[model samples]
Target chain A: MSHMQWQGYLRKDGRKGIRNYITVVYLVECAHHVAREITSRFKEHPVQLIGFAGCYPNAYADRVMNSLCTHPNVGAVLLISLGCESFDRKKLEENIRQSGRPVNSIVIQEAGGTRKAINDGVRWVDWCSGIIGNTMMVPMTVNDLVVGTVCGGSDATSGITANPAVGLAFNKLVANKGIAIFEETGEMIGLEEVMSSRAVNPQLAIELKKSVEKAARYYSAMGHGSFAPGNADGGLTTIEEKSMGAYCKSGDCQISGLIKPGDRPVQPGLYLMDVVPDGEPKFGFPNINDTVEIVEMISSGCHIILFTTGRGSVVGSAISPVIKICANPQTYRRMEEDMDINAGGILTGETTLRDTGEKIFEGILAVASGIPTCSEGLGHQEFMLSYKTFTPLGPGCLPV
Target chain B: MDKLIKIHSLDNVMIVTADIQAGEHLHIRRTEYYFDKPVGIGHKVAAQFIESGGKIIKYGVPIGSATEDIQMGGHVHLHNMKSDYIPTYTYEKQYPGDANPSLTNQSINQVL
Candidate 1:
């Protein structure tokens, strides 16, 4: 048996972070350049840039941004405000400070323009990085880890290899008392029955079913299904077909609860993140792209994300590391450096499902223990946040 | 050891594990059929004859229904198979069937 443990940064809020990063957040699109400049100036430092682009106020955006800024992985925050946007910079800074992380805000207009704001932001980041470098590290067990799985650019091999392998790893994590999450309700369209059947209780089953229905309705209102053209080229005949492959990432564990984006899991078990926005379909799509969903998973406090791809998606989130598991042997050969594991070995009969699954599980531990993922090493920190609306989860959503 | 993989025993389609050229003979479960068109890797090929509007079973679950009769060894994709839950978006505007009213209850009942 393989025995492994990780040392993570312990936050004052009692949460453990696998990475200590100084996050520079842009409150609006106008402040993006300044925030980017601040983080870019300290290229050698472990700093990440995240932000919202909309000028209009959104409760969902506010909640997600707050969760991200105060994420355990983030040791400090530098919020760049355009001074006129509706993103509540004061509330964001206050929340970060309350989480016991060093936080500072620079308003571009108030600081006498772009040059002054950028200069001020750079100084704040430098100071924050110094403080983060001195943060204490504590020994963390597997139970302290919260891992999330997402499948992007999927093909037939995904269902046969990587997705099921992820499911196996998820099962192992859940068995070890670690939190496991699988999101993309829009992608889980036809697997509602299979998914609901794995719920811990009948009420959660209903909620699971309703969540998928909401996704179907939401996509229908947008005049398109969530199925992309690349999915078709990848041999996924329908959204349901793609969903069956995507559903395998959840493994065979009973789902403990349901949560919308930004809602943290209260217990160590499997949870389904309802990515579809609540109420009418005002936003174009629940998740505009794969990175948006990744952002939501990060907001939910995932220490690391297991990203499976068949058509090859090379992406990493700002706040969390992404472990890429390539499902297609051909894709793996083409992008070996970008993938962390080659699950396609199962299709080639060179390895069994259990072997690949264990590899993915081990890969997770390695990443949490301070190993940089292929995406991280390649500098693929892709961040995106959009406007949306969501109603708070009902009491029944989490029975435990 | 075949290039096509049957994900579930009950699935009526098999996914091509590698690119197959036209006229290539595929052997599955002691049965052999010749491919009439090039099938790319990750694409689906019919395991048995499927009638028009019949459900296409993959992973032992219904992914969609056949728009036309598909012979054994025929390619199964958007050109022939379509979603039963929601209208599948295709480049060309074609069938616009009403959403299946029984989808919700039927899917739940089947799994339960």
Candidate 2:
């Protein structure tokens, strides 16, 4: 038996959470500042601010909110409504109530505007913080966790070291009966056939291919692939090269299913998140930035995200923690404080890839046991969600 | 110990583990080699003669194809290779270097 042991906040919905966060949600862009103010004063607590800035209603936004508010990691949520927006706070409150979480709503217009709203929201947070501390802690194992992996700011070294190490860790996670998800189909353009070959079924293989093909078409019509100027500077020549590097993070595990953003996995195994928006190029770049991708993973119930970077990234999610794995030795040295694992040690031959993978697997357990990740310690709860379109997956999307 | 690695036996390039200066001497696959042009760490150096339009293999897969003939030990980058997939994007503006040029300091790395 494994020596590692930890307890998790067992939710009424039967899911376990590594972190219990109190989130202040803004229903529209108008209430964003007030929500921020309410969360700001409660800095000592794990209170995060999240919201949709759209005044206009969106089915996608509604789905994202329903999943995020009741995310296993979230213990309580306070909705801030501007009172004039189309977002249905009552529906959201009902969703939270059904999930068996304490939820409250504050309307800026009805709560005497910004000053009074912030004051009222703060009081509720203060009151709820006391009661939420009593959440039952249950013994949990790796099987109770859902982890996601994504790579960003990649350089040539990424594929050779950190990403492959992550792949090894993902394989370990799957072996231990944990759920592992890898995303960024936009970056997997050149490896569709090879990627889909690992799918458990022919139907899922076809869906994987279609998702990558969709990403290729979306970026092609957008006038550029997801490759960036920094990639060029980091010795990555083209999108295919970057894709090859990014693909290493998925490891060699069999893909159990394909899913769009805001969709949850039904079983414990490896999954692929098709983050690219469906249909013709419509809502701008599929993801305007990295936080959008992080938000999507968090909404899909990822308890923690494995983030690999060669150039180094500093951001974490609002509810879940982000573990940064640095791919380059020089980049790791340059940004030591920000990195959680120095997979770059593989580049200098100081450590083997499997050793780094072992370190990362331990790191995940450590963070899940309430040890603060570097991002969480630095207070990097970055969150961003934007407009995008994704038609539901076909019936054959998930494997039997 | 060698200052670079070929990653795979079939790879046509070596990944430099240490920054190589123009006058530096190194050993690749136990053969003595000299660097005539500098290459930064994590950058690629041709492991063998690569003809124009020939694929550059790494991790036993084709990352890209050479745009021009590259001699053994030559630096391989955007100047000499192109992706087999879609065209990569680039900003038209020239920016200064060395202070972190990717995303803002407070922002997460945004690459896909």
Model 1 lDDT at residue B77: 94
Instruction: Write one digit per residue (lDDT tens) for candidate 1, span A356-383.
Output: 8899999989999899999999988899
Error of 2 at A160 (Å): 2.8
lDDT of 2 by residue, B27-54 (tens): 7656677888788876788898999999
Candidate 2 chain A has its poorest 10 consecutive residues by lDDT at A232-241
Model 1 chain A: lowest-lDDT 10 consecutive positions = A219-228
- What does the lDDT read for residue A207 in candidate 2? 87
DockQ of each: 0.32, 0.24
Task: Assess every candidate by TM-score.
Answer: 0.83, 0.84
lDDT of 1 by residue, B3-110 (tens): 787766678998787789988987778989798778998889899999999999986678889999999889999999887763222212333673443332233223
RMSD of each: 6.1, 8.1
User: Candidate 2: deviation at residue A15, Å?
Assistant: 0.4
* Pairs that clash in candidate 1: none
lDDT of 2 by residue, A180-205 (tens): 98898887877776688888989888
